[model samples]
Target chain A: MVKNRQWRLISFPSGRPEASNWELVETEAPEVAPGHLLVKALYLDVAPYMRGRISPQPNYAAGVGLGEVMVGGAVGRVLESRSPGFAAGDLVVADFAFGWQEYAVLSPGDVRRIDPALAPLPYWLDLFGLNGLTAYFALFDAGAMKAGDTVLISAAAGSVGQIAGQLAKLAGCRAVAVTSSAEKAAWCREAGYDAVIDYRAAADLPAAVAEACPQGVDLFLDNTAGPIHDAAMQNLALDARVVVVGTASLADTFGAPDTGPRFLRQILVARATVCGFLFSDYAARHEAGRARLRRWYEAGRIHSKFDIAEGIASMPDAFLRLLTSRNLGKQLVRLEGD
Target chain B: MVKNRQWRLISFPSGRPEASNWELVETEAPEVAPGHLLVKALYLDVAPYMRGRISPQPNYAAGVGLGEVMVGGAVGRVLESRSPGFAAGDLVVADFAFGWQEYAVLSPGDVRRIDPALAPLPYWLDLFGLNGLTAYFALFDAGAMKAGDTVLISAAAGSVGQIAGQLAKLAGCRAVAVTSSAEKAAWCREAGYDAVIDYRAAADLPAAVAEACPQGVDLFLDNTAGPIHDAAMQNLALDARVVVVGTASLADTFGAPDTGPRFLRQILVARATVCGFLFSDYAARHEAGRARLRRWYEAGRIHSKFDIAEGIASMPDAFLRLLTSRNLGKQLVRLEGD
Candidate 1:
């Protein structure tokens, strides 16, 4: 029998999660069942979405119960298998139901195989995984982005934002990014964004956005939905499309009452549409999204960056940093590096 | 030549419009010029949308200029004509640019002929006019109503609301109505709404809506923005569509700051869409919408009621009653007897 170390939820977080909210424990790995396999986690992802799962209030996805393993996604290698489709050395990615642990006993249906030859292993966790699929559908399908359209992306240096901005650029659209820091803004500019707005430094975000995309924003991929969303609403062009992908800025007020600028008049006058997008809605078509992302990655049309913590024990800190926008790119923890 | 009496805007309204905001003036009517005709007003429309045009801040449609006639739609008789297509004694409907007046000289392009054989004269001012077109396009195009969908319409006793609720029912959907009073609620039930919620009597609007629509709301036609909008946000079904058609509740706060519930979280979780809909967007497709509405009206699938004010001079009071939700069904002014 092997030992498995897992981070489990001890309590639901109120505002921002603290270290005491989770408890790290070690247990004997369970033996593989008839249709299951043993997985040794190679890389675990810590995303903004995980915050919702740890909350007591019901979120879009199911919340992690107290005393349960923290829910997340990870890339793992099959150590042992009972299913005919899987072998000991096969590399795979866990479904969203998997936990943030060093080892997991999972049914073959709960994971999908990944080819290491297509892209780097980390790319599977960053661009080719949830982040890539999110950017792919949010930009192309929900956003309805077209050539010559001006696209604005908030949280431009973060995981999904980075991919969305690059995709907009690839579609022959003008891409404008909103970032909190000058460093991140520089990175966004280097990533082919036509203009970069340091939201922290701008006196008026809407004015800055207007100056950047003088034609006005036709599509906006919003990750931080607070003041950024209000500004985007004010700057929408006629028939604009706004995709609400994440609310990192409103994490603390998720279950509370929060008020911002009223958008009814603006949206009505502009004849704009605001859509809330989730990748799970397109679960059956993820392969199609992945195929397009793979083509982009192989052609060097897209790039992904990972801000990885060294060990499985670093997940909580990494996640907290992600919430505060301290990390530069996709936040991850390397449980067992190659 | 005839004496023309006109109600002109003297100043922009701050809150609800008052009598002093308009000035009644008498002038000699101009002769019919080339391509122009002299029209004697028959009926005039008073709608919630007219409030936006009277405000100081520009709305989707052009604002009524100070000291100019308040822009609106009116049905009149061609008293004298210079155009070959129009003849004296022919009935016609003026475009939205027409002023509130008893007599005027208009270009033939500024009006359309109305067939008396199709519907009553007042119907041209109510259900067969812009109001009908608004309900038709807003429900079909913006709301995207599907059969069996649970449709919730706010201001269910008003002009557009009354028509929209019946249209939803005719489309094989479950129609629910939200109104300010029990009288209106009873009227909504008589009009074929599957359920009716008296918002003023309900302790909790969202809870009442959920109880009324156990399956949740698939489409929401929101005419009042303040608290009703908040409640609708809280009760959205997955993939819900919210059409922001009017803001009667926010008319007092149009130029001032008004804060209420933030809808981003609810929309994101439910994967819903909130669209600001204006009838002007479908101006090019008005005939298509009218054709559909005409069929429904002729087949008795739709009904319209008008609260008629005695004369053109009663427009301000009629409009104020509409703002306060005191008037039921479509509000209209009789400028001349049949």
Candidate 2:
């Protein structure tokens, strides 16, 4: 029997996560039941929203239980299948709740076969997967983006950011990206965005976004919602649409994001719309979103970037880094080298 | 020459209007110009939104200037006309921009011919006018009300509130009206609402709203923007729509409405939408809105309650009452004896 090491919740985090909140343990290999596929975990995706999940909320999906494996999304290789489709080395995307483990057992319904031709393995976890689908639907469906509209994307160099920026350009929109670093700005600029604003360097972000876009922002895709949201709120044009996808700003415990005063008034005066969305709600449309996203990727119209941390054992640290915005793009941990 | 006693703005109030801010003066009517009509003001409309116009903003028209008759919408009789289509004794809606005055001089473009058959003189200032159109479009067009959906209207006894509540009910929605008093609650119940919540007495409004509407609120017509807005944010169902029309909360003067903790999370989790709109933007559609509202009134489906304050000299005190939420339904000033 193979021994599996898993990251379990030791305690709830109060603020920034530390190693103490998680405990690593060895467990017996998960049994492959009938109609179930055993996946040897190859990569674990780390995201900012995971922090909100660590603390239990009655409204949301079940959070990480004490001594239970930490919850996440993962890409793995199907080592054993008990169903009609027997596979030995098929790359698959698993929706198994907890991903920071060496192996997991997933029902066929919870897993999707990945086409290896779609860039690389990390690309599936980043661009053509949940992250990319989120940015696409949130901007297009919820935001109601039109071609030639000025788009402002927050957290624009992250995994979702790289693809969103390129997608906006592909759709003939003028994309203005906001990133935390100069390097990420350079990355966003190279991604074909019309303008890239280094949010950290720009003391007056509203002025910078206005100056960079020239025309006011028509659609704003917000991933990090602190000062960036406040700034974008002021600079948005009449009838603007804002999609709130993630709140990296709230990762710090005991303190909320520092959204400045006059935020709602900004929404009022501009006749703008602010909507929040979850990717799971769009699950039925996922395959369609992915199909369109795949076409774009195949046509070289979009790009995916990942900041892979090296080991399953370092999952806790990687997750902590993800919460702190330390990872440039989609934060992930590779169990083994590609 | 006709002797006209008018209420003039002696000074613009920095905060709230006081008796000293207005002055009553008698003047001799001037001769009508080449394209101007002289109107004998009949009914002057008093609305909460007019407070915003008086305060120095880029509104429908300029601010009510100091030492000038207060700007308002009024129903009047054209006493003398220099324009071809206008005739003496014709009932008309005029924005001479001086409704608080006994007489007004208006250009042809600023006046609309009124059909007295469909509505009485007061109807021109209430249901078939700006107040009614504001309620109709804000609920139907901006809020996008659907049949069988649940609607929660704040300030349900005020001018727009009374009209919007009836509109929502007519649209086949489960309309819940939030009012500040027992009298208003009884009025809302008689106004054909499914539920009425007395916000003044309720300790936990969100819980109260949820208890009243077990399935949850689908659309919120927000006029009071403080705790009611926060509660509406919490009680919103997935993809719920919130339409913000007025800020009647006492806290509106300070800054942006304060959304309590977990408000943004509630919005994100519910996948809800919050949008603000001004009725004046739909000026082109005003006639269409009026026609539909007129049909509702003639069919005996719509009801309007007026707190008529007699005389143009009472305009200052009348405005003070409107601002303090002391008036129910449409607050009107009778400029002439009926």
Best by DockQ: 1
All candidates: TM-score = 0.78, 0.74
Candidate 1: misplaced stretches above 4 Å?
A261-338, B261-338
How would you encode candidate 1's per-residue C-alpha lDDT over B203-271 as one tens digit per residue? 998899989999877888877677887777667776677776766676656667435644343343334
Could you tell me how far off, in angstroms, the CA of residue B19 lies in candidate 2 after the best superposition?
Answer: 3.5
Candidate 2's TM-score reads 0.74
Which CAPRI tier for candidate 2? incorrect
lDDT string, candidate 1, A212-241, tens digits: 989877887877677887777666665577
Reproduced native contacts, each prediction:
0.14, 0.11
